[model samples]
Target: MKLVKVYVTLKESVLDAQGEAIKSAIQTMGYNQISDVHMGKYFELKFENDYANLEKDVDLICDDLLANPNVETYRYEILEGE
Candidate 1:
């Protein structure tokens, strides 16, 4: 089997409001050293070992469904799975 670990994040040009809020809250709690934060999404997909079009399919899935092409970008790693 194969485990696909996908990470999706906003493009650099886009503002991460949620992350900024989290950082503000953390700073209010007295952690003044906080510089910046960015929020993102992670996904795990399991595929059979025999799947021949894994990479192509993964890219299509990410581009078509997992992420917004205009504001977000994604990268994934394939790992051996039990």
Candidate 2:
């Protein structure tokens, strides 16, 4: 089997409102050293090892559904799965 780890994050030009809120809460907790926070989404996908078009399909999935091309971006890593 194969494991695909996907990470989706807002583009640098986009505002991360949720991340800002979390950072504010964290700062209230006395973590003054915290400078910035960027929130993102993580996804884990498992597929049969024999999938011939795994990379291409993963890119398509990310482009079409997982990440928004207008304001978000995604990256993935393929790994061996138990």
Candidate 3:
């Protein structure tokens, strides 16, 4: 078995309202070093070792289903075998 770690985030050109809200709330609490914030999503995909094109499959899923190409971008890594 293998573990796939996927991270999805909005492109720099897009606005991050959720991240901004969180940063503002934090700053209001007196931790005022926050200059910027960005929000994102994470996914862990576990699959058996049967598939030959796991990386390709993951890329396809990220591009087609997990992320919005115009507004978001994604990157992934395969974890160490246990």
Q: How far is candidate 1 from the true structure (C-alpha RMSD, Å)?
A: 0.6
Question: Which structure among the candidates has the greatest lDDT?
Answer: 1
Instruction: List lDDT for all candidates, in order.
Output: 0.98, 0.97, 0.93
Of models 1 and 3, which has the larger lDDT?
Answer: 1
lDDT of 1 by residue, 1-82 (tens): 9999999999999999999999999999999999999999999999999999999999999999999999999999999999
Question: Candidate 1 — worst ten consecutive residues by lDDT sum?
Answer: 31-40
Off by over 4 Å in 2: none
Off by over 4 Å in 3: none
For residue 44, give model 3's deviation from the true position in Å.
Answer: 0.4
- Model 3 lDDT per residue over 1-82, tens place: 8899999999999999999999999999998999888999999999787868999999999999999999999999997545
Alpha-carbon shift of residue 43 in model 3 (angstroms): 0.4
**CA lDDT of 64 in candidate 2?**
94
TM-score, one value per model: 0.97, 0.97, 0.93
- Name the lDDT of candidate 3: 0.93
Off by over 4 Å in 1: none
- Show pairs that collide, candidate 2: none
